[model samples]
Target: MIPWVHIDTGTIPNGGGTLRLMRRGQEFSIQLGQNELMNSRLSGSEVALAELACGRIAARSGARVLIGGLGMGFTLRAALQTLPERALVEVAELVPSVAAWARGPLAEVFGGILDDPRVRLLQTDVAAPIGAARAVYDAILLDVDNGPDGLTHPGNDRLYDHGGLGLARRALRPGGVLAVWSAHPDAAFTRRLRDAGFTVEEVPVRANGRRGGARHRIWLAARPDGAR
Candidate 1:
């Protein structure tokens, strides 16, 4: 077995917790306490989060996207691949070290996606942009925490709550999509999406793409075009 090595440790902002970077040969992992937040090898669902959301807005010109959480940059890379050159992707990351780790120890995994011209990296809470906007983004991709049932920050719960869902709906342009990734499914959260006036679709995906791994859930909630 290739022994795992501890590379760096980061403190999550607002008392979220500590994030540790561990490496086993070429494979890297970001862990919160004992729980693994993300692994370099398992990026299928993360890729899908961007693919599915960007696919929905493929026809939009100069599409703008807001991606919450820059974990490993899988979603960001995938989004860049799917969107056109004119598209702009704003990545909000509350923990600054995660971004540093991407450029530092995890540079190879990130593949220089952060340096892309379309990417705008923001070291602030995603909610700030979401709250400050009014029908601004074409798509909002959230792979934050462990989905609605977050593990790192207590404030993350607001991002999944009814009020938060309403904020997300308002932040999105008409027919814009809000995609969320989760380690598990929450039926109530599904209900919350519908209650927030979004057309929701719950998708089950593999963690390692087609090869198979853990089954995860992704919620694709679309705001109606006629909605104000």
Candidate 2:
């Protein structure tokens, strides 16, 4: 087995803990404390989530999209491929080192994406972008933390709550979609989407693509044209 090399490191939330970026062969992973948070190899969910989020909106000639996480750049790359030439994607990633790894060690997989004119990388918490956007996006795709029950960062739990869902609803354009990727099911979180005045639909897509294997749920919520 090849040895894993440390690419870089950063702390999550005021240095609450450290996140180590490690590489083995062509794959990369983000580890928090001792657990592997996310990796590039098993990125099926990222692609599915991005596809589900973009959906028909991506077919629109000039749609604007917001992607909450940039892990592996699978979601961004998928979106870039599906969307039209004039589409725009704003990627909000909290960890700067993750971005660094994307450009450096993991460059072969994610580097070219950074140079795409359609993409804008924002090094900030996903919440900030959601809060600040004023009904400006056609779709918002979130895969920041593990799931509704956040394991890496407790702060991310709010994203699955009514408050965060409400903000997401407000940030989206009329009939715009808000797609969330989860590692597993969260019934209560689905209810929260309804409570926030979104027409919700739960879809299961494989981690590897539509071809086969264990499935994961993707919550697609849409804000009503007259909600606000």
Candidate 3:
């Protein structure tokens, strides 16, 4: 049996604890304590997060997307694959070390997507970009924390709350979609989305691509054209 080798560790932003990177041959992982945050082997839910949201906005030309996390770059890469060439992506990663990991140990997984002309990587809280936007983006996908529970960063809880949902609504164009990735489902968060004037859909997806793995959740919320 091959033992997992610890490669490195990075501190999570906002006093969110530390993430340890581990490798065992072809597989890689980022973990917080004993719990795994993300893995190179299981990217189905992350990819679904991008594919589902982008598919909703496929008709829009030059669509703009904002991804709230850079976890192993799976969501970003999946988005890049799904979106049209004219589309653009802005990835907001709160932890500086996570970005460094992406460019460093995880570079092969990221595959130079950071250098893509269509991308602008921002090392800041997701809220910074969301607050600055006003009907400017076609889609906003948040794969932060452990979803509505806010496991990594305590501050991430606000992203699923009413105020955060409100800002997301304002940031998106008419009929724009807001996608959220979670390790599990939250009924309260789903209710909050509707309260924020978004028509929500909670989807169940596999962790690994079309195969065996734990089920994850994705919330697809769309702002109607006439939504205020």
Best by TM-score: 1
Instruction: Give the range of the ten consecutive residues with the poorest summed lDDT in model 3.
Output: 144-153
Cα error, residue 209 of model 3, in Å, equals: 2.4
Q: Point out where model 1 deviates above 4 Å.
A: none
Candidate 2, overall lDDT? 0.83
lDDT of 1 by residue, 1-228 (tens): 999999999999888889999999999999998899999999999999999999999779999999999999999999999999999999999998998998999999988899899999999999999999999999999988787866787888889999999999999999999999999999999999999999999999999999999999999999999898
Best by lDDT: 1
Q: List the residue pairs that clash in candidate 3.
A: none
Tens digits of per-residue lDDT, candidate 2, 1-228, equal 999998888776644477898889877888887777677777787888777778759766679999987878899998888888999999998877778878777888785988999999998888898999888899999987667765656777778788888889989988899998887888998888999999999988777675665577788998887779
Tens digits of per-residue lDDT, candidate 3, 1-228, equal 899999998888668898899999988998888889899999999999999999999778999999998989999988988988899999999888889998898899999999988899998999899998989999999987767867778888778788989999999999999999998888989999999999999999999969869989999999999777
Model 2: residues >4 Å from true position, as ranges?
210-214
RMSD of each: 0.6, 1.8, 1.1
Error of 1 at 220 (Å): 0.3
**How big is the positional error of residue 28 in model 3, measured in Å on the Cα after superposition?**
0.7
lDDT of 3: 0.91
| Residue 53, candidate 3: alpha-carbon lDDT | 99
TM-score of 3: 0.97
